[model samples]
Target: MSTATITPKGPGTLRGARLPKWSPYAIAAGSIALAVGIGLAGGLHSRVQWGLIAAILYVVGTYAIATAVEGKRQAKDRIATSLVWVAFLLAVIPLASLVWSTVARGLKVLDVYFLTHSMGVVADTEPGGGIYHAILGTLEQVGLATVIAAPIGVLTAIYLVEYGRGRLSQAITFFVDVMTGIPSIVAGLFILSLMLMFDMQPFGFAGSLALAILMMPVVVRSTEEMLKLVPNELREASLALGVPKWRTILKVVLPTSIGGITTGIMLSIARITGETAPVLLLVWGNAFINANPFEGAQASLPLYIYQQYANSAGSGAAYDRAWAASLTLIAFVMLLNLVARGIARWKAPKTGR
Candidate 1:
C-alpha cells in the first residue's frame, strides 16, 4: 500500500535576480561623475567629449552590472536599451545646443522694429535696419513656387499611383528621383542659363522657378506615398456605386489622404525656404522693399542673411542682424511645421464616423 501511494516532489523554480528600478539612474549618475573626473584629470576641455565618455561609461556599466545581477540574456537586453538611450541623448544634446545658441545670439538684436523695418539707407556697419523687405520677398517667392509646384506635383502623383501602367510611369518616377537629388545651386544654374538665353535679369520669380524645381519632386514623392496608403477598398466601393474613377479619386482617395498630402506640401515648402544659393543667384538681393516679384530684384531672408554676413566685414551690427534674420527664418520654418501638423490633424479621417 505505501509503495503504491508514493509521489515524486515537484521541480523547484529557478528565478534570475533582477536589477532595481533605480539602477539605471544610479548608473547614469555614476557614469557622469566618473566621466567628469576623467575629463578633468585628462585635461579634456570639450563638453561634447565628456558627454561621449559618459555615454560609453553608462553603457558599459549597465551591461556589467546587469550581468552581475541578472543573466547574460538580461544583460544583453539592458545593453541594447542603454545604447538606444545614449543615442537619443546624443541626438538631443546637439539640437538643444543649436537652439540655445541661436536664441542667445539672436535676442541681442531681435525686436518688433527689427522685424518691421527694412535696411533702407542704412549701412551694414550701422546699428539700425530690419528684415521687412527680406520677409516680403521670401513670402512672395515661396508663395509663387508653391502655386507652381503643388498642383503639378499632386497631379503627377495621382497619375503615378492611380493610373500609372507602363514605362512612362517608370520613367517619370526615375526623373523625379533624379530631380530630388539635384543641388539647389544646380537648379539655380539651370534657371540662370534659361534667363541668360532670354536676356532676363535677376528677379523674385526667377528664384521662385528654381525653388519650384526643387519643391516639385519632394511634393510628388510625398503625395504619391500618401495616395498609395489610401485603401483600395474605398476605391472599389465607390466604383461599385457607379462613381466614375476620377470622381472617386477626388471624393474618396483625396479626402482620405488630404491630411498627409497637406503635411507633405508644407514640408516641401520648409525645405526650400532656407535656400541661399538659388536666391542669391536669381533674386539678386535688394536693400529696399520690392512689392512686385516679376519686375525687379528682391531680397529674401536667406539672401539677406548671406549678404549681411558677407558684407559685414567683421561689423558687429551686421553680424547681429544676420543672427536675427536667421532666428526669424527658423521661426518661420517652425511655424510652417506647426501649421502643417495642425492641418494634418484637422483633416485626418475619422474612423468613428
Candidate 2:
C-alpha cells in the first residue's frame, strides 16, 4: 500500500473508464439489426419473437459493454435500465395499436348522424343506425350510480378516518376490502336477486344500482387515503379554536382532500362506465329509445357495443357500429380522466405567493 499507487497516474492502480451516453442508442440499434438478421436466418415469422430477441440482445449487450468499460455496478444499472425500457414498450405498443385501429375503423360511420340518432327503426343488418339511445342510457345510468355511490363512499371514508375504532370499524374495513374485489357479474347478480324478489323487470335504474355497487369500494378507498393525508395539525388547531370536530372536518379536513376525493370519484365512475355484464343483466338493452330509465329496459354504450359484436359482428353495418361505439367508450373514459386531472389541478392547494 504505497502512497504512489494511490496517485491518479501511478502504476499497479486501476484507471476508471466510462461509456458515453450514446452507447445505449448504438447498442440498441445494433441489437435490433442483429436480431433482424438472426430472425431472417432462423426463419422466425413472428415480429414479437424478433422484438423479444432484440430486447434480450440490448440488455445483454449493455451489461457486457458496461462491465468491460466501467464496472459490475454500472453494468447492473444498465441492465435494469434496459429492462425498464423493455417493460415500458411492452405496455405501450398494444395500447397505441388499439387506439389506432379503433380510430381507423370507427371513423367509417362515426358521423354526426350516427351520434345524434338511434337504432329505433333501423334493422341490425342495415347500413344506417346510431348510438343516441345507448349514450342517453349510459349518461343516465352512470350519473345515477355516481349520485348513489359518491356520497355514501365519502361518508364512509369520513367515518373511517375520523370516527372509526374497534370491531365496528374493523367490520366496515373488511367489507370495503371485500367489495373492492367483487366481480362485476356478482354485483349484477345481487341487484338481479333483488329485482327478482320484487318481481320487477329490467330497467336502467337497476343497472345504476349495480354500477353503484361496483363504484363504491373504489371511491371509499381513494377517499380514505385522501382523508388520511390531511394534516393532523389542522384538526388540532381547529379544535383548539373551539370548533366542533364535525365542523373542523367539514371546513378544514374535507376541503384539503376534496380534490383527491373528487378525482377518485371520477375515476370510480370511469371504472363502472365500461361494465357490460351488469348492464346486460340489469338493463337488458333496448334497441328502441326508452326515455324513462325507471320504466323500461334501456340501451347503454357497453351493452350496445356487446350486442353489435355478439349478434352481427363483421357483417356490414354492425361491425362498423361496434368499432364506433368502442371508440366512443374510449373517448368517454379519456374525457373522465382529463376531467379528473383538471379538477385535481383546480382544487389543489396553492403553495406559492
Candidate 3:
C-alpha cells in the first residue's frame, strides 16, 4: 500500500468572488433608461426630478438585490462604503465650483496699478485705478477691531470656562448666544445710533467698534470651548506647587490653551474682515486716501467691492476693480491663517510632558 499526501486550501480561497466591474455600468445604464422613460411621461420640471429619483432608486435597489445574493453583512458594508465615497464627491464638487468662480472673476483685473493706486483716478470707464487706500483702511479698521475685541473676548471666555458656575454664567451664555445671532446690519445700526447720540459723525473707528461687537461673541464662544479642554490636573499640579490661583491660571492653564485661543482670534478676525454693512454705515470715503481712522473717512475692501458693483455702470473697469479687491481680501485672509498657524506651532507645548 502507498501513502497519499493531502493539501489543504487556505482560508482566503474560501472567500466569495467579487462582483464584476461591469455590474455598476449595467446598473447605471438601466437607471438612465428608467429616468428617460419617467421624464418623457412627466414633461420638463418633473423630468429633471425623475432622473434624481431613478439614480437614488437604482443605488438602493441594486444594493438590496446584491445583499440578497451575497450575505447581509458584506452587502451592507459594501453599500455603505460606496455611499460614503459618493457623499464626499458631492461635497467636493460645489466647493471646487465656488473656488473656480472666484478665481476666474478675480483674475480679470488684478494688476500692479490695482494694488498701488487708489480709486481716486479710476473712473467708471477708466481701468487703471488701484486698491491701496482700501487695503490700508481695511488693515487699520480690522486691527483696531481686533484690539477692541480680543481682550474682552479672551477674558469673558476665561471667566466662563474657569470661574463661571452660577445663574449669572448661564445668563451671560444666553446673551452671548443672542448676540451671535444678531445680524451684521443690526450691529451696524447700533453703532450708528451710538455715534449719533454722541453727536459724532460716523468714521472708520466707528466701523471698527461695530465689527468688534460682531466678532467678540464669536471669539468668546470659541475660546471658552478651547479653555474648557484644558486639563484640571494641570491646574491642580500648579496649585500644589504653591502657585496662587491667578498665577496658576496664567502660567499653567493659559499657556496650554494659547494655541486654540489664537486660532479663535484669527477666525474672528476673518469673520469681521469682510463685513460690508458696518463699514458702509460708519466710513464714508469717495476716492481719496485716508490713513486716519478716528477723524477722517476711510474705505475698506468690502466697501470698495460694494461701491464698485453697485455703480450705475454695470460691468466696467470699476467692476473689475471690485473683483480685484475681492481677490486681495481673500489673500489677506489667507496670510492671517498662515500667521495664526505659525503662532500656534511656535507656542504649542511639548507633547507627552
Order the candidates by lDDT, highest first — what do you get?
1, 2, 3
Q: Note the Cα lDDT for every prediction shown.
A: 0.93, 0.92, 0.82
Question: How many residue pairs clash in each candidate at the backbone level?
Answer: 0, 0, 1
lDDT of 2 by residue, 153-173 (tens): 999999999999999989999
Quote the RMSD, in angstroms, for model 2: 4.4
lDDT tens readout by residue for model 3, 1-353: 11112234458776554455556556656766777777787674664477566657566756875575555776787678657755774588678876677778889989786788787766755777788899989999999999999999999998998889999999999999999999998998998898889989767899999999999999999999888899999999999999998899898999998998998899889989999998998886557788889977898999988888887276577777777788888888988898888888888887764
lDDT of 1 by residue, 59-136 (tens): 999988887767699999999999999999889988998888888999899999999999988999899999999999
Instruction: Indicate the TM-score of model 3.
Output: 0.84
Q: Candidate 1 vs candidate 3: which has greater lDDT?
A: 1
The alpha-carbon lDDT assigned to residue 122 of candidate 1 equals: 94
Model 1 earns a TM-score of 0.95
